[model samples]
Target chain A: MTRPRVTFWRLFIVASLALGAYSIFVRFHEGIGGATNLSDGTPWGLWVGLDILTGVALAAGGFMITAVVYVFGLERYRPIVRPALLTAFLGYLFFVIGLLVELGRPWNIWHAIIYWNPNSALFEVAWCVMLYTIVLALEVSNLIFERFGWVRLSRVFHAVVLFLVIAGVMLSTLHQSSLGTLFVIAPGKMHALWYSPALPLIFYVSCMCAGLAMVMVEAFLSQRFLKHPVRVDLMARLARVLMIGLMLLTLLRFSDLWLRSALPLAFQPTEEALAFWVEVALFQVIPIVVLWPERRRASPRRLFVGAFSAVAGLVTHRMNVATTSFVSSSPTDYFPTWMEFSVSIALVVAGVVVFWGFAKWTPLFAEGEHPPHAAHRAEHVTRARPGPPTAISGCGRARRGARRLPAPRRWPGGRSTAPGTRC
Target chain B: MSKGMLIDITACTGCRACVNACRTKNRLDAPPGARLSETDFTVLEHRDRLAVRRMCYHCNDPACASACPVAAMVRTPEGPVAYDEHRCMGCRYCMVACPHGVPAFEWHSRMPRVRKCAFCPDHVAEGRPPPCATACPTEATLFGDRDALIKAATARIDARPERYYPGIWGRDVAGGTSVMFLSPVPFDRLGLRTDLGPDPLGHATGRILALVPGTAATVVTVLGGTYWLYRRRAAVAAEQALAAARDGADAAAREGREGGR
Candidate 1:
């Protein structure tokens, strides 16, 4: 049963990748005019809206998790930190790729590096994203170094891990907010419901929520598919943080709208108002209600549902902000072509396939294993132990069995007393 | 010294001479379209009795120039907003940023570039008016210094209040533009955006971007401080645990010696 299911997924990924390649060919061969429904009135469409905007926001988990574990010294979350970093690294890597694909002159993407336009929000976003991606790459490189048994290199990375985490946080904060600042220039073009001077602050807060939600979703997925143990305690705490973030975002959005006297716009009979309400319901109301109770937060299934809703809400919000809001002002309407959809799906499939590869081959989930780095020694004293060679073994039974195992012993230095015990 | 055009919509005869002259000057082969496009840098829109010439306004603080991340769109001192196609990465941000919906893209080309009126800076520099303005049969498209043109537009409106819209369209729209317009009716009636306020659109984003350095500094300081505090707490806890273990061991050793005696 498992073999067949795995084969089915493998075939799906391969097919999606093939279709994606063809889409790329069409996009480049036919140019944007022939391939997309976009026009002069709507220059940025699905690719900019989804692949770049939503993808980058969803990847905020890397900075959030790193800040939690390293900056706050939350030793229990250390196991998930590497996974989160890997996700962020891939998210940004694909964002750059998406940018290249969407750009009319992909070769000239480097012009942004040499040209100085401090006044342009995109210029600031481009610089921050570039620096942050590099920071994320360095953060995730520890897993690669560990996979190859490059103890010295891993140690070198660990020595400056704190510095990297701090830098990542700063960079992520700037770019995430600057993404919203991109829209601040065209106040007349965007619908009143999504436009505001406080957009940068609003984006920053919502991304925090989305980032935490993504971590929860990723955790649930890894546990179910990869046969990894789910740390319910840690996830519940994360859910609490997500709840606060969502509440804060909701407050910020509504207050900004109310202060601007645009709240009445939400009640108007227009498509923009409809989109705005839907965004609000999905992004705020549904997730907050689902994750409100402590019991629900503790239940992995319920938590996954909430996180999934939030993720979906985030995509909707970004799409609205990036594309839908311009509908009224744009002379022509735009709906993404099948080619655009295929390319976006292909990017996601590629991300998951790479993540699956890392999980299968690397010690991405070895709970107590410490890299041979002096920086880590102060936090954890556990000796390294190789995790299961195949992370995808007996799914439901393995999780149940893991739950029944006795809690691992801990020493005064917070090291596992029983070195060989699985978490 | 900034040059501009005073377009008198009331005087326009709905003739295509100015459009033809523009095509000739730019050496454009494609026939003129009804709307502004890659090939049609300028278009004549017929609204009832008015023939509005739609083109780039070339604002004092141009949003397209501010929005271009690569500095591909530049506002020259000579009053033309020039596009450096070689530098553009085809982000198409200028199209979205322009309040007038001006900057058209070459969506059909593999190596696309943003298309719009160049304002003919070279022509003006050479002491010649733009071809479209020079070709205007009724002198409806008058080219001169921006300040002088605004004054001329005001005088025309003031002299015959019923003949004009009683106000200059671009005197302060979007923080003032080089191309001022005089119309027989309200500007909005001719499908122009009158809602854009008197501030440069870039100011909205500029205000936010100015906070970036301070934001980065605060983030770094707060994160660094939090890490230090947490590490110190962890260190203190570890020391207490170590001292407790040492004391227990000593107590055990003393008890064992007493028991042996």
Candidate 2:
């Protein structure tokens, strides 16, 4: 049953990748005008709105999960941390590719490194994204080190894991808020309903909601495809956290509008007003309502619905901010071309394919306590008491089943010394 | 002394001499269309009886310069904002940040650069007025020191209250622009934005970015302190667990010896 589905996905990914490559070649050969719908009036289209902004915002899960486990010392949440990190790393890697396609002079992208513009909000965002991507790479490297049995190197990373987590959180906060700051300079061009003096604060709050909901979405997907177990208690707690974030975001949005006296704009019978209401409903109202009851929060299906809604809502909000709000001011109309949409969809597919490869090849969902170094064995041993059924327990069963089944011939080693055993 | 321009809309005729002069001076290939583009640095738009010439305001604190991530857009001390194409990465952020929406991009080029009014920096440096200002049939466009031009604009407004708008259009808008305008009617009716306010737009973004260092310091201290507290607590718990287990073993051994006796 699974074989046919797996082959279908593989074929789909390959076709998408080929189309993306052709579109990219056309972009470079014919220039941005021939390839994209973007014009001088609308210099940014789907590449900036969906691929860069939405993609980066969704990847906030990496910092959120790491802070929960490493900084807050919640050891029970350890099993999901590696998966979240892998997702984030792939998300950022694809963001760079999207940016390359969007940039008019792709080769000069490194000019931001040598040149300085401390006053520019974009300058801050560029620096932070570069730094944070590196930070995430280092954090995810522990899995690689363990898979190859580089115990000493992994120990070095383990020793300073706390510092790395703290830095990642700080970098994430800066860039995430600075994205909103980019639009703050153009109050006259942006619609009053979307424009506010507190935009940076609003962006930061909304990202927290998106980040938490994204983790839940990933958890549900992995459980279905990878045969990983879903921890009902842990997911319930995450749902509670997501509910609080959604509430905070709602409060921030309404209060900002109210304070600016732009609340009346939301009631107007206009396209902008409709978009705003839809965004609020998808991101704020629906998630909060679905996750309100304890029984619904515990049910995996309900939790997935709420998470998917929040993620969809985040995409809507970002698109509205990036494109729709400028409709009244822009001289020309912008709708992304088929080539643009293909490239964006292709980047997303590429991310999924890379994540799947990482999951299959590495010990991404290893069972038991996985301390990177033996130095941390004492801490793990002390906290080794059995708790609720988790992904860890599910992974142990999966490992045993894998031993009986035929292992893939492509692997360098046999089943006994596979990637998961060392870790 | 900063250079500036004062455009008196009341004096302009519907002739297009300035537009022709600007095109000729820049060596542009074709005649300008209805709007600004890479080929047209300035354009004259007809609004009822008045003819308004639109170009870069050359703001005192330009949002474009502040918005450029690589310092590609720069504000010259001579009062005009300049573009350094070699430094630009073509992010198009300046186009987004501009209040008047002046910057134009070359979408058809493989390596596009942002294009806008240069304010004739070369002409200004050589002590000659811009070609458009010199080519004006009437004294519609005047170029001189920014302060003298502001005084001239105020004098014109004060003398002809009935003929012109009540105030100088660019005197305080967006924290004061080097190029001021005298319009027969309200500026907004002429497609100029009046709601940009008196503060520089860059100040808003600057204020947010200024808080970064403090935010980073606070995060580090809090997270570091919390991790230390948790590790210490775990160590103490582990020591207690080990001591309790040892005690249980000693009791079992003693009870076994007593039973044997």
Candidate 3:
């Protein structure tokens, strides 16, 4: 039987790209006023808040993977690093493009470099994002260089990989937390429900949870989509990271709620209050319940759902803080236009397509941690022709039972009797 | 002399004319108050009954500048928050990290960026004033040296303690505000969150951060260099191991072929 082929994502991307391009041209001619719904009352709407700030945090899965692999020497995560980096790279790339279009004087966007502006938080965010993107690009480029047989270039990049990795890690850390700092200034405007001194720190830590959740979801989907079996060891490790981040996130929230005298407000039973309770319930409480256990984390289905819930919770929390919970008596109420949603869709779909194409074409999957199921995952059709197998059976799929390095070949040291293979 | 802009929200009428003037003077899109883009610097926001003219105050020690791993948001000596989108990675962390909720992120479309008010330093440097200050119909906002703004803010507070209520903002809030404010109503009533203390928001975490560029540069260089060396060693070992494995595989394949022959 032929495997199910999906064209929806690619087709959707083409449509959105067309719209985005058209809208961009329209911006040039008529200007952004005609294109966006931003107003003096509601200065930033969906594009500025949702697609960029929130999106960047979601894409943070890349650096966390790298840190695990290179910094902590978690050899098991090495395989997932390339894919995670690719996702991070594309997420930032889309963000970069989206930001460029938003620039009023696109040409003068470089003035921040020639003339320093140490007085602005935006300035730091800009520089960090720029430098970090270059770092991520270099990290991803190493994979390409190795794949193309450019041994020397690959060596140079590999030598510098640690630098790029560390840089990426540091950059992600600063900006991730800084996102909360943006809203900290508006204590009056933000609902007492969400505002706190530790907001920036909380936002940063929350990203850790969101990113790990996305990684879990990505792992499951990739396993199914790419026809690779999930590696148990890597999944277990990833689950542990998610568990730790969530635990910390929970502690931070509780401590902050206590310090601010805001704990009682959560009990008022208002809509915002209820939403808060529900969000925490999903993002922190429920996930903790399912994830605190090692056995549950090891299960693929449980891990996926738990991670999805955590990511959803974080995303909602961001939206709440940025817009929903904070009812700045400000005259603006922002809603992303269909065009905005289209653009967001385009970025996500593009990242997916890129990941799939790059994986098929390049050696991106040669990561340090090929999941515990490396043998099973790697036991796909030959690279030349990726097709369904002749007979789908337990033996065919389970042929990779002893894929570990220490494990002897399946069926013991049984060398092929017919082929004069060295025993 | 560290100079800063003084913003008196009581004088603002929500006209957004200052936004228009800033855009035209800044060579921006001149979009109406509704169509805010990254170019629409000095946008206006109506919080409750308040008309907050949003712009980047040329802070004395800005979190944005210090957080910058690269020198993108450099505060001019005179005190203007200038930006370079090209140098910016569009991370939008500044939007997230800013204490005043001033910086805006560009989150839509194919290409996005940040949009914030850079004080009209070009005109100010030429001995004029910021466009927002000049364009205000009610003179709710003023452009002057930091000292004068502080003095004026203090006098207003001293003269009418009951009228001003609480205290003058930026006088001691979050280190200090480059743009000072004098409100007729309570600041909280005006939808401005004035609860932040004078402590540097960055330092509020109770951790002292090295914010200078030279220090950050050194840290980046040292960290990067250290990681590079470690990775080089690891890559070398991994390569040697891979080479050995490949050689063994090739020899085994050759033996198998010869045996078949």
Compare the candidates by lDDT and give the number of the best one.
1
lDDT of 1 by residue, A199-297 (tens): 888888888899888888888989888878778888899889899999989999999999999999999999999999889988999989999988888
Q: Please state the CAPRI-style docking class of candidate 2.
A: medium
Computed on C-alphas against the true complex, the DockQ of each candidate is: 0.62, 0.58, 0.13
Worst 10 residues of 3 chain A by lDDT: A411-420
lDDT (tens digit, per residue) of candidate 3 on A167-227:
7887887777656655554445567779886877788798888887887777777888776
- Candidate numbers sorted by DockQ from highest down: 1, 2, 3
Query: Candidates' lDDT values, in order?
Result: 0.85, 0.84, 0.66
| lDDT per residue (tens digit) for residues A1-423 in model 2 | 379998998899899999988898888888888789887677778888889888889889899889988877776677678888888888889999999998988899999999999999999999999999999999888778767777446656765677788989999999998999999998979888888878888888888789878888888888887777777777888899999889989888998899999999989999889989999999999999999988788689889999999999998898888888887788898888889988998999998887877788877887233433332443334234344232255666444433332322111221123323333
TM-score of chain B of each: 0.97, 0.96, 0.69
User: What does candidate 3's lDDT look like per residue over B224-246, in tens digits?
Assistant: 66656666776687679779999
TM per model?
Answer: 0.91, 0.91, 0.66
Off by over 4 Å in 3: A1-10, A23-30, A269-271, A368-423, B1-261
Task: Write down the DockQ of candidate 2.
Answer: 0.58
Candidate 1, which segments miss by more than 4 Å at Cα? A367-423, B248-261
lDDT of 2: 0.84
Comparing candidate 1 with candidate 2, which one achieves the higher lDDT? 1
Among all windows of 10 consecutive residues in model 1 chain B, the one with the lowest summed lDDT is: B230-239
Is candidate 1 or 3 superior in lDDT? 1
Off by over 4 Å in 2: A367-423, B243-261
Residues B42-124, candidate 2, lDDT per residue (tens digit)?
Answer: 99888866788988989999999999999999999888899999999888999989988899988888888899889989998
